[model samples]
Structures are given as structure tokens and as C-alpha cells.
Target: MSQHSENTPILEARNLIKVLGGNRVLDSVNLDIGRGRVKVLIGPSGAGKSTLLQCLNFLTPPDSGHILLEGREVNAGSKKELCSFRQQVGMIFQDFNLFDHLSALENVRVALMKVRGMSKLDATERAVAELKRVGLVDRAAHYPANLSGGQKQRVAIARALAMDPKVMLLDEPTSALDPELIGEVLTVIRALAQGGMTMIMATHQISFSASLADEFIFMEKGRIVEHGSPAELLGKGVGSRTQAFCAKISELTGEADGEFRS
Candidate 1:
């Protein structure tokens, strides 16, 4: 993993609250994500992990809160500001989100060309480099329909990386993939973590989370119930609720206790 000074936080959220249809989905959430560190958000379904990420990316503006990227506030109300913030904070969705008609290269290149306003040649070169980084260079010409689920997610990751984002937000990245396919995507993600890319991920892959995450934040009822290193959060001293949650996740993922490996 990339070495980083503990004092510098690349992204921070303060009192982030999001309400949808008269219900609070996120409640006074706060976090400081250090540069080059991997943070794993773990919780039961509908625990607001996805909503918090959406707020961080400005995909769904929070009802009330503030987000800071490299110490500058993200102004969600302004379109230009929101666009710039999004460029710095990339998002990887669960569904892959690749355009069906576009080749993997085009899917990655189009964003570089249109959003970053690069020339087609420049965008193509950058796109290919990102594809190579994600181990998808050989499949650059394949369309979404022609690629496997894992390949498509890698393309999506490549597309995000082409933006040169400071932070990546992944929401249930491997949930939709077949059991066999999940490994490929997880491998790519582990490589990214090892390369020191700052990331916050929500996933059901408890083993991967335990092995790779620098810190774990467990959410419940839209609040962070526990936040600490894997050993602390999964250790014997934690509350029963936290322990039970981790046990359930471990049971489901077939990961033994204290199986962390970086």
C-alpha cells in the first residue's frame, strides 16, 4: 500500500445528512479519508453506505451537509462546482454502467474527450493506458455485451481512472458479478489499493475488506456505530452488535476470524 502522512485527509465529510421522501437516509455522518489509504464501509443492506457515497460524489446532493476535497468545500448547488468536484471524486457503480453500443475504448475515451476536453488522439491514448493499468488492454475493442461481467467492471474502473481522480468511491462493486467473476474485479481493486489510490468502498466481500482496508466504518440506522481498524472493529472487545454483524458477514463470505492479509 502507498505510504501516507496520517495528518493529511484528502476528503472529509462533516455533518452530512440526506433525507429522502420524509425519511433520513444519512444522519449527521462525518468521516476523514486520508490520502492513499483504503477505507471500507461495512453494514447491512440499506444502511446508507450507497447514499453517503452519492452525497460525496454529488450524484445525489445531501439535504444538509458539507463535503471537502483537499480542503475545499464542494458546492453542490452550483453546477460548475459540482462538475469539478465529480471529476476529482470518481464513482464505480455495481451495474458496471458501460454503454452497450460503445467499445470499451470508446466508453473510456468519450469521457476524456467530452468532460476533460481532450483531443480524440490524446483521449484514445489515455484511455488505452488506463485500460492497460486495469489489465483490459487486450479487450479494448470489445463492447459491453461481448465482455464478461468482471471485464465490464474493469472497463468502468478504467473509465474512472482516465479522469485522474483523487479519490474513488465504489458501491457494492462485486455484488452483481457471478462468484467466479468476483475474483477478477477484486484483484484489480486490490492492485489499485496496493498502488496507493485513495478509495472508499462498500462491499459484501468481507474477506477482501478485512485484508485490504486501512480502516473500517460500520454503519447502522444511518449512523456510524463503529469505526476503527479491522482488528479493533473485529476484535473481541467490540460491542456485541458489531461483533454479531461481523460474524454474520464472515459466515456469509466464508472468511475465518482474524484472516486479514494485506
Candidate 2:
């Protein structure tokens, strides 16, 4: 992997809070993630992982807190500024949010054409390259309905990469795939991790997360209860609630410490 430009934290969230239906989905969450580092977010179900990711990317506005990307904050002062920041932050979802009417190639090409204003030829070329990077070049013409779960997820990943985003947030990317298909999607993520992309990934893939993550955050009931390196979080054990939750998952999956290497 190439060296990270600088060790400075590229994004920061301070005192973030979110509420839905009189429930606190996020509470006073604070995080500082460095550039070119993989930050894995982990926990049991409904732990606010998705909420945190959405808030950071402005997909869901924080109820009371602020998000700073590459040092400057996202504020209501200017639409241009907000657009600029939003473009720099890309996201991937469990549902593989590709347009049903568009082919994989077209999906990737859309942002480059509309957002970056690249020519069709240039965008197509870039889209092809990114699809190849995700091991989906041959599937470029396939639409979401025609592709397998893992294939669709890979196309989604390629779509995000085509935008050349500065920060990528992945929310349970493999959860929707069949048991046999998860590996294909994880492989693409592994490649990206090896390339030193800055990411805030909300995952249940403990093995991959442990092996690739520069840091791990464990959330429970709308708050971050513990956080550390892969080895630290899964090696020495975790809090009582986290330990119980992970243990339960381990039972069903036969291996809960997901994509992380021992």
C-alpha cells in the first residue's frame, strides 16, 4: 500500500446526537479517524452504526452536533461548500443502492458524468477500470436484477470508487448476500483496505475488520462503549454486553470475529 499523505485525522465528529421517534439513536458520539486508515465500526444489532455513518456523510443530518471533513466543518453558510463536502464523502449500503434501470457501467458512469462533468468516453473508461478493480469488469453491462448479491455489491463499491471520494462509509455491505457470496464482496474490500483507503466501515465481518482495521469502535444502545485496534478489541475480550453479543453471533456464524485475521 502507498503511504498515507499525512497522519492527520481527515475527519472528526464531536458530541454527535440523533433522535428518532423519541428514541436516542446516537448520543454524544465522538470520533477522530486518520487519513488512509480503516476504521471498523462493530456491535450488536441496532447499535447506531448506520446512524453514525449517515451523520458523518450528511445523509442524515445530526440533530445537534457537527461533522468536520478534512479539517473544515459542514455548515449552513453556503450550498456550494456543502455540495463540495458531500461529493468528497461517498457511501455504500447493504442493499447495493444501484439504479434498477441502469447497467453496472452506467451506474458507475453517472457520477463522473454529472458530478465531475467528465466526458462520456472518459467516464466510461474510468468506470471500466473501477469495475475491473472490484472484479466486475465483465459484468459492466449487467443490471442489478441480473447480477448476484455479491456481484451487485461489488458494482456498488465500484460506483463509489468511480467518484474518487476522499472518504468512504460502508454500512453492512455483506449482510444481504447469500452465505456463499459474502467472500466475493469482502475480497474487494480487502483490496481497498490494502490500497490504504480512508474508510469508516460499519460491519459484522469481524475477521476482516480485525485484520484490516486500524481501529475498531464498539457501540451499544446509541453510544460507543469501547474502541481499540483489531487485536485489542477481539483478542483480550470486550465488555460484558459486547462479549455476549459477539458470542451469540459466533454461535450462528461459527465465527463472529469476522473478516479479521487472527
Candidate 3:
């Protein structure tokens, strides 16, 4: 990439607004994500973090406002344009949205063949590599029914990775996993971060996120209540919304909130 492109945010959301069932789910939210950055979204259940992520990917189209990819505004209304845009941006849901009938490898390979028009051999090769990346190569032949929750989610991540996305938007990626299985998925995500993947994630894994995220964006009532470096917002003695929320979370989950720094 050129110097200008390298400096620009890989993704931007400007004044994003979204409503559902007569409620403003996303209220004029704005965000910027630079290359190789990790941003974590934290808030209560009804705080609209998921809605903001959905709108960013146009999964749930916004009511108004604009989405810019690499500094260029996107035309979300055009199917062709939206398809092209989505190819560059991946979404990982809390629930592993895998096809039950397809094996792990097939689940990852289908999108490459259908969307990118890759041949069977090439798609198979790419899918195997992705499955290996997520440490699920041994489970490649297994169907969703046969795999554990963590394995299924790994398959989901592999499917998304096959698209070669520029940015990843993950909404509570571990929310569906059992306590014992959460770490496996998180390890994969941590490796992705180490390898310079640009990502925005909404998660309740406070300590884990605080330890890794470049920024903590706290949302409430469909709006961003606070945003700053995790160290500043979550450091000891910081009187911030993120700190208060993390305290409450640490109380409930029994995980210390002190890892937000370094």
C-alpha cells in the first residue's frame, strides 16, 4: 500500500444511525479503524454494540449515515457494490453460522468457490490452510454436529479468512462457547492480532480484551459513552466509565481488571 493508504483508516463509520422495531439501536455512531489495529467494544447487553457492528458490515442496514472503506464511501444500496464491499470485510458472529450438512472443510471452501469462483482444487487447498491456521485441520472432515463449539467457531473463522478480508468485525465471538472452550477460540484471535489483523470486536471478556485491545470503546443506550486507550480508561485509579464497567464485570466474572495495562 502507498503511504497515504497506509495512513488512512481501513474502515470508517460516519454518523451511523440504525433503528429496529421503533427503537434507535445505533444512534449516530462514528468510528475509525486503522490498519493492524485492535479495537474492543464494551458495554451492557442492550448497549447497541452488536447493532453498530451489524450496521458497519451492512448485515443489518443502517437507517442513515455513511460507511467508508479505505476512505471511499460505500453504496450499501447496490447489491453488486455491497457484495464487493462485503468480500473485503468479514463478520464473525457469536453463534457459529456454519452449514450443519457441510463438513468443516466444505464449510470454509463453499464461499471461495461460490463468491470468488475458485476451482475445487484451489478452494480445497485454501480451506485446508485456513483450518490449519485455526488449529482445526484434524476436524476438517467433521460436520458441525460432530465438532465441539470451539471447533465449529474455528471453522467459521476459517470460512471468513478464506475471503482475504481487509478488516474483521466480530460480535461477541465467544459468547456462545462454554467456559472451557472459550480459551481455544481466544487463542486464535490473539494470534490473529499478533499477526497484524485489523479487527473490531464486541465482547464481555473484559480482562482479555483489556490486555490486548489498542482502544476500549464503551457504549451505552445506543451511543458511545467513552473511548480511549485501555490503559487510560482502565488503569488503576482512573475514574472512567470503562473502569466502572470493568469493575462490575470483574466482580461478576471473578477476573481481575488490572490487566488492562500492558
- Best candidate (score: lDDT): 3
Against the true structure, what is each candidate's TM-score? 0.93, 0.92, 0.97
Ranking by lDDT: 3, 1, 2
Off by over 4 Å in 2: 1-5, 236-241, 256-262
List all candidate RMSDs to the true structure: 3.2, 3.2, 1.7
Per-residue lDDT of model 1, residues 90-119, tens digit only: 899999899899999999999898899999
Candidate 1 segments whose C-alpha is farther than 4 A from its true place: 1-6, 237-240, 257-262
Candidate 1 vs candidate 3: which has greater TM-score?
A: 3
Kindly provide the TM-score of model 1 when superposed on the true structure, using C-alpha atoms: 0.93
Q: What's the TM for model 2?
A: 0.92
Q: Write the per-residue lDDT of candidate 3 for residues 1-262, one digit (tens) a residue.
A: 6888788999999999888888888899999999999999999998999999999988899989999999999998799999999999998999989998999999999989999999999999999999999999999999999999998888999999999999999999999999999999999999999999999999999878877899999999899999998888987777898888888888888776555432
Model 2 agreement with the true structure over 64-170: per-residue lDDT tens digits: 88888766777834777777787887799989989899999999999899988999999999999999898888999988999999999999998998887888999
Q: What is the lDDT of residue 33 in candidate 2?
A: 85
Deviation of model 2 at 95, angstroms: 0.3
For candidate 3, what is the lDDT?
Answer: 0.92
Looking at model 1, residue 110 earns an lDDT score of 92
Clashes (backbone N, CA, C under 3 Å), per candidate, total 0, 11, 0
